[model samples]
Target: MKLYYSRGACSLAAHIALYEAGLAFRAEPVDLKAKTLAGGADFRQVNPLGYVPVLELDGGERLTEVGVVLQYIADQKPETSLAPPAGTMPRYRLMQWLAFISSELHKTFSPLFAPHTPEDYKPVIRERLAQRLAYMNQQLAASSFLMGEQFTVADAYLFVVLNWAGVMNLDLTPYAHLQSFQKRVGARPGVQRALQAEGLLGS
Candidate 1:
Protein backbone atom coordinates (compact mmCIF):
# COMPACT_ATOMS: atom_id res chain seq x y z
CA MET A 1 0.00 0.00 0.00
CA LYS A 2 1.03 3.58 -0.61
CA LEU A 3 -0.30 6.40 1.56
CA TYR A 4 -0.41 9.95 0.18
CA TYR A 5 -0.21 12.36 3.08
CA SER A 6 0.67 15.89 4.16
CA ARG A 7 2.84 16.13 7.25
CA GLY A 8 0.92 16.61 10.50
CA ALA A 9 -2.43 16.62 8.75
CA CYS A 10 -5.30 14.32 9.75
CA SER A 11 -3.53 11.76 7.57
CA LEU A 12 -1.01 11.31 10.32
CA ALA A 13 -3.60 9.26 12.18
CA ALA A 14 -3.58 6.68 9.43
CA HIS A 15 0.19 6.80 9.22
CA ILE A 16 0.43 6.05 12.92
CA ALA A 17 -2.11 3.28 12.57
CA LEU A 18 -0.08 1.68 9.76
CA TYR A 19 3.01 1.58 11.92
CA GLU A 20 1.08 0.31 14.95
CA ALA A 21 -0.40 -2.46 12.86
CA GLY A 22 3.07 -3.40 11.69
CA LEU A 23 1.93 -3.11 8.09
CA ALA A 24 4.29 -2.86 5.17
CA PHE A 25 3.57 0.24 3.13
CA ARG A 26 5.21 3.19 1.44
CA ALA A 27 4.53 6.79 2.42
CA GLU A 28 4.17 9.41 -0.30
CA PRO A 29 4.32 13.01 0.75
CA VAL A 30 1.90 15.38 -0.93
CA ASP A 31 2.18 19.09 -1.48
CA LEU A 32 -1.39 19.88 -0.52
CA LYS A 33 -1.21 23.53 -1.51
CA ALA A 34 0.18 22.74 -4.92
CA LYS A 35 -1.82 19.54 -5.32
CA THR A 36 1.32 17.83 -6.52
CA LEU A 37 3.39 14.81 -5.52
CA ALA A 38 7.12 14.69 -4.73
CA GLY A 39 7.72 13.87 -8.41
CA GLY A 40 5.61 16.95 -9.36
CA ALA A 41 2.77 14.86 -10.75
CA ASP A 42 -0.79 16.11 -10.34
CA PHE A 43 -2.20 14.82 -7.05
CA ARG A 44 -5.64 15.60 -8.36
CA GLN A 45 -5.26 12.49 -10.47
CA VAL A 46 -4.89 10.51 -7.25
CA ASN A 47 -7.76 12.20 -5.45
CA PRO A 48 -9.55 14.97 -7.31
CA LEU A 49 -10.44 16.51 -3.98
CA GLY A 50 -6.74 17.32 -3.71
CA TYR A 51 -6.45 16.24 -0.09
CA VAL A 52 -4.07 13.88 1.63
CA PRO A 53 -4.65 10.44 3.31
CA VAL A 54 -5.44 8.66 0.05
CA LEU A 55 -4.39 5.04 0.45
CA GLU A 56 -3.58 3.08 -2.70
CA LEU A 57 -3.83 -0.66 -2.15
CA ASP A 58 -1.60 -3.18 -3.87
CA GLY A 59 -4.26 -4.05 -6.45
CA GLY A 60 -4.42 -0.28 -7.21
CA GLU A 61 -7.67 0.51 -5.40
CA ARG A 62 -7.60 3.76 -3.44
CA LEU A 63 -9.31 4.77 -0.18
CA THR A 64 -10.10 8.33 0.82
CA GLU A 65 -11.26 10.16 3.98
CA VAL A 66 -9.26 9.94 7.16
CA GLY A 67 -11.84 7.99 9.20
CA VAL A 68 -12.46 5.42 6.48
CA VAL A 69 -8.79 5.10 5.66
CA LEU A 70 -7.99 4.64 9.34
CA GLN A 71 -10.52 1.87 9.83
CA TYR A 72 -9.27 0.15 6.69
CA ILE A 73 -5.76 0.14 8.07
CA ALA A 74 -6.88 -1.23 11.44
CA ASP A 75 -8.99 -3.96 9.86
CA GLN A 76 -5.98 -5.19 7.93
CA LYS A 77 -4.28 -6.35 11.16
CA PRO A 78 -6.99 -7.38 13.58
CA GLU A 79 -4.61 -9.04 16.00
CA THR A 80 -2.99 -5.70 16.57
CA SER A 81 -6.41 -4.57 17.82
CA LEU A 82 -6.08 -1.13 16.30
CA ALA A 83 -9.87 -1.25 16.20
CA PRO A 84 -12.62 -3.38 17.63
CA PRO A 85 -14.34 -6.16 15.73
CA ALA A 86 -17.03 -5.02 13.27
CA GLY A 87 -20.74 -5.10 14.20
CA THR A 88 -19.88 -4.97 17.87
CA MET A 89 -20.90 -2.30 20.34
CA PRO A 90 -17.27 -1.45 20.95
CA ARG A 91 -16.79 -0.93 17.25
CA TYR A 92 -19.81 1.35 17.19
CA ARG A 93 -18.32 3.27 20.09
CA LEU A 94 -15.16 3.69 18.07
CA MET A 95 -17.18 4.97 15.13
CA GLN A 96 -18.90 7.45 17.42
CA TRP A 97 -15.57 8.80 18.55
CA LEU A 98 -14.33 8.97 14.94
CA ALA A 99 -17.41 10.87 13.82
CA PHE A 100 -17.15 13.30 16.72
CA ILE A 101 -13.50 13.95 16.03
CA SER A 102 -14.01 14.41 12.31
CA SER A 103 -17.14 16.53 12.34
CA GLU A 104 -17.01 18.32 15.68
CA LEU A 105 -13.32 18.82 16.30
CA HIS A 106 -11.66 18.64 12.88
CA LYS A 107 -14.18 20.78 11.01
CA THR A 108 -14.11 23.41 13.74
CA PHE A 109 -10.40 23.90 13.19
CA SER A 110 -10.81 24.48 9.45
CA PRO A 111 -11.99 28.07 9.62
CA LEU A 112 -9.06 29.08 11.79
CA PHE A 113 -6.65 27.69 9.20
CA ALA A 114 -8.32 29.55 6.34
CA PRO A 115 -6.48 32.73 5.51
CA HIS A 116 -9.70 34.47 4.48
CA THR A 117 -11.34 33.82 7.82
CA PRO A 118 -12.18 36.99 9.68
CA GLU A 119 -10.08 37.58 12.77
CA ASP A 120 -13.17 38.47 14.79
CA TYR A 121 -14.72 35.10 13.98
CA LYS A 122 -11.72 33.08 15.06
CA PRO A 123 -12.49 33.57 18.75
CA VAL A 124 -15.93 32.14 18.16
CA ILE A 125 -14.39 29.08 16.57
CA ARG A 126 -11.93 28.83 19.42
CA GLU A 127 -14.73 29.00 21.95
CA ARG A 128 -16.55 26.20 20.19
CA LEU A 129 -13.38 24.16 20.11
CA ALA A 130 -12.92 24.78 23.80
CA GLN A 131 -16.35 23.38 24.53
CA ARG A 132 -15.56 20.26 22.48
CA LEU A 133 -12.23 19.91 24.17
CA ALA A 134 -13.82 20.23 27.56
CA TYR A 135 -16.16 17.40 26.77
CA MET A 136 -13.28 15.26 25.52
CA ASN A 137 -11.32 16.09 28.63
CA GLN A 138 -14.15 14.79 30.76
CA GLN A 139 -14.44 11.64 28.66
CA LEU A 140 -10.73 11.01 28.76
CA ALA A 141 -10.66 11.60 32.50
CA ALA A 142 -12.54 8.33 32.89
CA SER A 143 -10.32 6.23 30.66
CA SER A 144 -6.79 5.98 29.40
CA PHE A 145 -8.13 6.40 25.89
CA LEU A 146 -11.34 7.26 24.09
CA MET A 147 -12.22 3.56 24.34
CA GLY A 148 -10.97 2.80 27.78
CA GLU A 149 -7.50 1.32 28.23
CA GLN A 150 -7.02 0.06 24.71
CA PHE A 151 -5.37 2.50 22.36
CA THR A 152 -7.56 2.07 19.34
CA VAL A 153 -7.52 3.96 16.06
CA ALA A 154 -9.77 6.54 17.72
CA ASP A 155 -6.89 7.53 19.94
CA ALA A 156 -4.71 7.99 16.90
CA TYR A 157 -7.35 10.22 15.30
CA LEU A 158 -7.83 12.26 18.46
CA PHE A 159 -4.11 12.72 18.96
CA VAL A 160 -3.64 14.09 15.45
CA VAL A 161 -6.51 16.55 15.76
CA LEU A 162 -5.41 17.71 19.20
CA ASN A 163 -1.97 18.38 17.71
CA TRP A 164 -3.50 21.18 15.66
CA ALA A 165 -4.02 23.11 18.89
CA GLY A 166 -0.36 24.11 18.75
CA VAL A 167 -0.66 25.34 15.16
CA MET A 168 -3.69 27.41 16.09
CA ASN A 169 -1.98 28.65 19.22
CA LEU A 170 -4.90 27.50 21.30
CA ASP A 171 -3.74 27.01 24.85
CA LEU A 172 -4.58 23.60 26.31
CA THR A 173 -2.97 24.02 29.71
CA PRO A 174 -6.41 24.24 31.29
CA TYR A 175 -7.18 20.73 30.15
CA ALA A 176 -4.73 18.85 32.30
CA HIS A 177 -6.05 15.45 31.31
CA LEU A 178 -5.64 16.33 27.67
CA GLN A 179 -2.14 17.60 28.21
CA SER A 180 -1.21 14.30 29.83
CA PHE A 181 -3.05 12.42 27.11
CA GLN A 182 -0.91 14.11 24.48
CA LYS A 183 2.23 13.15 26.30
CA ARG A 184 1.05 9.57 26.68
CA VAL A 185 0.10 9.16 23.03
CA GLY A 186 3.12 11.03 21.76
CA ALA A 187 5.39 8.66 23.66
CA ARG A 188 4.14 5.62 21.77
CA PRO A 189 6.73 3.97 19.54
CA GLY A 190 4.49 3.85 16.49
CA VAL A 191 3.42 7.44 16.88
CA GLN A 192 7.03 8.50 17.31
CA ARG A 193 7.95 6.67 14.12
CA ALA A 194 5.09 8.33 12.27
CA LEU A 195 6.12 11.76 13.55
CA GLN A 196 9.72 11.26 12.48
CA ALA A 197 8.68 9.95 9.09
CA GLU A 198 6.68 13.14 8.51
CA GLY A 199 9.54 15.30 9.80
CA LEU A 200 7.39 16.52 12.67
CA LEU A 201 10.05 15.23 15.07
CA GLY A 202 13.81 14.76 14.95
CA SER A 203 14.99 11.28 14.11
Candidate 2:
Protein backbone atom coordinates (compact mmCIF):
# COMPACT_ATOMS: atom_id res chain seq x y z
CA MET A 1 0.00 0.00 0.00
CA LYS A 2 0.97 3.61 -0.60
CA LEU A 3 -0.24 6.41 1.68
CA TYR A 4 -0.52 9.92 0.35
CA TYR A 5 -0.32 12.39 3.22
CA SER A 6 0.24 16.00 4.21
CA ARG A 7 2.56 16.68 7.13
CA GLY A 8 0.83 16.55 10.52
CA ALA A 9 -2.66 16.43 9.04
CA CYS A 10 -5.31 13.91 10.10
CA SER A 11 -3.64 11.55 7.64
CA LEU A 12 -0.96 11.01 10.28
CA ALA A 13 -3.44 8.90 12.17
CA ALA A 14 -3.79 6.48 9.26
CA HIS A 15 -0.02 6.50 8.78
CA ILE A 16 0.48 5.56 12.42
CA ALA A 17 -2.17 2.84 12.13
CA LEU A 18 -0.27 1.24 9.24
CA TYR A 19 2.94 1.18 11.27
CA GLU A 20 1.24 -0.03 14.44
CA ALA A 21 -0.23 -2.88 12.40
CA GLY A 22 3.26 -3.72 11.11
CA LEU A 23 2.20 -3.23 7.52
CA ALA A 24 4.73 -2.50 4.80
CA PHE A 25 3.80 0.66 2.95
CA ARG A 26 5.25 3.68 1.18
CA ALA A 27 4.25 7.29 1.72
CA GLU A 28 4.11 10.22 -0.69
CA PRO A 29 3.67 13.80 0.42
CA VAL A 30 0.81 15.81 -0.98
CA ASP A 31 0.71 19.56 -1.46
CA LEU A 32 -2.73 20.08 -0.06
CA LYS A 33 -2.87 23.77 -0.90
CA ALA A 34 -1.88 23.14 -4.49
CA LYS A 35 -3.94 19.94 -4.74
CA THR A 36 -0.99 18.30 -6.48
CA LEU A 37 1.29 15.37 -5.84
CA ALA A 38 5.06 15.67 -5.57
CA GLY A 39 5.18 14.54 -9.21
CA GLY A 40 3.03 17.57 -10.09
CA ALA A 41 0.01 15.52 -11.02
CA ASP A 42 -3.38 16.87 -10.06
CA PHE A 43 -4.43 15.25 -6.79
CA ARG A 44 -8.01 15.26 -8.05
CA GLN A 45 -6.95 12.37 -10.28
CA VAL A 46 -6.55 10.30 -7.13
CA ASN A 47 -9.46 11.75 -5.15
CA PRO A 48 -11.57 14.50 -6.54
CA LEU A 49 -12.02 15.84 -3.06
CA GLY A 50 -8.27 16.61 -3.08
CA TYR A 51 -7.61 15.40 0.40
CA VAL A 52 -4.76 13.48 1.94
CA PRO A 53 -4.79 10.06 3.66
CA VAL A 54 -5.72 8.37 0.38
CA LEU A 55 -4.63 4.73 0.64
CA GLU A 56 -4.02 2.97 -2.65
CA LEU A 57 -4.11 -0.77 -2.17
CA ASP A 58 -1.85 -3.01 -4.23
CA GLY A 59 -4.79 -3.91 -6.44
CA GLY A 60 -5.26 -0.17 -7.26
CA GLU A 61 -8.36 0.26 -5.13
CA ARG A 62 -8.21 3.45 -3.05
CA LEU A 63 -9.61 4.21 0.38
CA THR A 64 -10.26 7.64 1.88
CA GLU A 65 -11.33 9.11 5.23
CA VAL A 66 -9.25 8.74 8.40
CA GLY A 67 -11.75 6.62 10.34
CA VAL A 68 -12.27 4.05 7.58
CA VAL A 69 -8.59 3.99 6.66
CA LEU A 70 -7.51 3.41 10.26
CA GLN A 71 -9.98 0.54 10.65
CA TYR A 72 -8.84 -0.99 7.35
CA ILE A 73 -5.21 -1.04 8.50
CA ALA A 74 -6.16 -2.54 11.86
CA ASP A 75 -8.34 -5.23 10.28
CA GLN A 76 -5.43 -6.13 8.02
CA LYS A 77 -3.61 -7.57 11.03
CA PRO A 78 -6.09 -8.61 13.66
CA GLU A 79 -3.50 -10.26 15.88
CA THR A 80 -1.96 -6.83 16.33
CA SER A 81 -5.23 -5.89 17.97
CA LEU A 82 -5.08 -2.34 16.75
CA ALA A 83 -8.86 -2.57 16.78
CA PRO A 84 -11.41 -4.91 18.29
CA PRO A 85 -13.11 -7.67 16.31
CA ALA A 86 -15.81 -6.43 13.97
CA GLY A 87 -19.51 -6.73 14.98
CA THR A 88 -18.55 -7.07 18.61
CA MET A 89 -19.45 -4.72 21.45
CA PRO A 90 -15.86 -3.61 21.83
CA ARG A 91 -15.72 -2.88 18.12
CA TYR A 92 -18.80 -0.76 18.43
CA ARG A 93 -17.17 1.17 21.25
CA LEU A 94 -14.18 1.76 19.06
CA MET A 95 -16.44 3.04 16.30
CA GLN A 96 -18.23 5.21 18.81
CA TRP A 97 -14.98 6.83 19.88
CA LEU A 98 -13.98 7.35 16.25
CA ALA A 99 -17.27 9.09 15.48
CA PHE A 100 -16.91 11.30 18.52
CA ILE A 101 -13.37 12.30 17.57
CA SER A 102 -14.33 13.02 13.97
CA SER A 103 -17.54 14.92 14.50
CA GLU A 104 -16.98 16.52 17.88
CA LEU A 105 -13.26 17.06 18.16
CA HIS A 106 -12.00 17.21 14.57
CA LYS A 107 -14.78 19.33 13.11
CA THR A 108 -14.54 21.83 15.95
CA PHE A 109 -10.92 22.56 15.02
CA SER A 110 -11.80 23.22 11.39
CA PRO A 111 -13.29 26.66 11.94
CA LEU A 112 -10.36 27.80 14.06
CA PHE A 113 -8.04 27.11 11.14
CA ALA A 114 -10.17 29.05 8.67
CA PRO A 115 -9.18 32.67 8.03
CA HIS A 116 -12.75 33.73 7.36
CA THR A 117 -13.90 32.86 10.87
CA PRO A 118 -14.90 36.05 12.68
CA GLU A 119 -12.45 37.09 15.40
CA ASP A 120 -15.20 37.55 17.99
CA TYR A 121 -16.56 34.05 17.48
CA LYS A 122 -13.16 32.35 17.81
CA PRO A 123 -13.25 32.39 21.63
CA VAL A 124 -16.73 30.87 21.68
CA ILE A 125 -15.57 28.11 19.36
CA ARG A 126 -12.49 27.53 21.49
CA GLU A 127 -14.59 27.30 24.63
CA ARG A 128 -16.87 24.70 23.06
CA LEU A 129 -13.85 22.73 21.88
CA ALA A 130 -12.41 22.92 25.39
CA GLN A 131 -15.58 21.46 26.82
CA ARG A 132 -15.20 18.44 24.58
CA LEU A 133 -11.56 18.04 25.58
CA ALA A 134 -12.44 18.25 29.26
CA TYR A 135 -14.92 15.43 28.83
CA MET A 136 -12.23 13.35 27.16
CA ASN A 137 -9.93 14.11 30.06
CA GLN A 138 -12.52 12.73 32.46
CA GLN A 139 -12.77 9.59 30.37
CA LEU A 140 -8.98 9.14 30.30
CA ALA A 141 -8.74 9.72 34.04
CA ALA A 142 -10.42 6.33 34.50
CA SER A 143 -8.28 4.40 32.00
CA SER A 144 -4.96 4.38 30.23
CA PHE A 145 -6.56 4.92 26.83
CA LEU A 146 -9.91 5.76 25.30
CA MET A 147 -10.80 2.05 25.49
CA GLY A 148 -9.20 1.09 28.75
CA GLU A 149 -5.64 -0.24 28.44
CA GLN A 150 -5.63 -1.21 24.78
CA PHE A 151 -4.26 1.37 22.35
CA THR A 152 -6.76 1.19 19.55
CA VAL A 153 -7.15 3.14 16.32
CA ALA A 154 -9.37 5.51 18.28
CA ASP A 155 -6.34 6.68 20.19
CA ALA A 156 -4.47 7.27 16.96
CA TYR A 157 -7.26 9.47 15.61
CA LEU A 158 -7.57 11.34 18.89
CA PHE A 159 -3.84 11.84 19.23
CA VAL A 160 -3.61 13.38 15.78
CA VAL A 161 -6.37 15.84 16.60
CA LEU A 162 -4.93 16.67 20.00
CA ASN A 163 -1.60 17.46 18.40
CA TRP A 164 -3.38 20.32 16.68
CA ALA A 165 -3.76 22.14 20.00
CA GLY A 166 -0.15 23.33 19.88
CA VAL A 167 -0.44 24.48 16.27
CA MET A 168 -3.72 26.29 16.81
CA ASN A 169 -2.69 27.75 20.16
CA LEU A 170 -5.53 26.05 21.98
CA ASP A 171 -4.21 25.81 25.52
CA LEU A 172 -4.53 22.35 27.00
CA THR A 173 -2.83 23.13 30.28
CA PRO A 174 -6.08 22.76 32.18
CA TYR A 175 -6.60 19.16 31.13
CA ALA A 176 -3.79 17.29 32.81
CA HIS A 177 -5.08 13.86 31.88
CA LEU A 178 -5.28 14.81 28.25
CA GLN A 179 -1.80 16.31 28.40
CA SER A 180 -0.35 13.08 29.79
CA PHE A 181 -2.31 11.11 27.25
CA GLN A 182 -0.59 13.04 24.50
CA LYS A 183 2.83 12.17 25.91
CA ARG A 184 1.94 8.49 26.27
CA VAL A 185 0.74 8.19 22.69
CA GLY A 186 3.67 10.21 21.35
CA ALA A 187 6.16 7.84 22.98
CA ARG A 188 4.85 4.81 21.11
CA PRO A 189 7.31 3.48 18.53
CA GLY A 190 4.67 3.23 15.84
CA VAL A 191 3.60 6.84 16.37
CA GLN A 192 7.23 7.95 16.40
CA ARG A 193 7.79 6.24 13.06
CA ALA A 194 4.80 8.00 11.56
CA LEU A 195 5.95 11.38 12.88
CA GLN A 196 9.45 10.90 11.51
CA ALA A 197 8.08 9.72 8.18
CA GLU A 198 6.05 12.90 7.87
CA GLY A 199 9.06 15.06 8.93
CA LEU A 200 7.24 16.16 12.06
CA LEU A 201 9.86 14.62 14.35
CA GLY A 202 13.60 14.57 14.65
CA SER A 203 15.57 11.45 13.77
- Score candidate 1 by lDDT: 0.95
Q: lDDT of candidate 2?
A: 0.94
Candidate 1, run of 10 with poorest lDDT: 194-203
Report the lDDT tens digits of candidate 2 across residue range 37-156: 999999999999999799999999999998999999999999998999999999999999999999999999999888899999999989999899999999999888999999999999
Candidate 2 regions exceeding 4 Å error are: none
lDDT of 1 by residue, 6-108 (tens): 9999999999999999999999999999999999999999999999799999999999999999999999999999999999999999999999999999999
**Top model by TM-score, which number?**
1
C-alpha lDDT of residue 184 in model 2: 97
Q: Show model 1 residue runs off by greater than 4 Å.
A: none
The superposed Cα distance between candidate 2 and the true structure at residue 75, in angstroms, equals 0.1
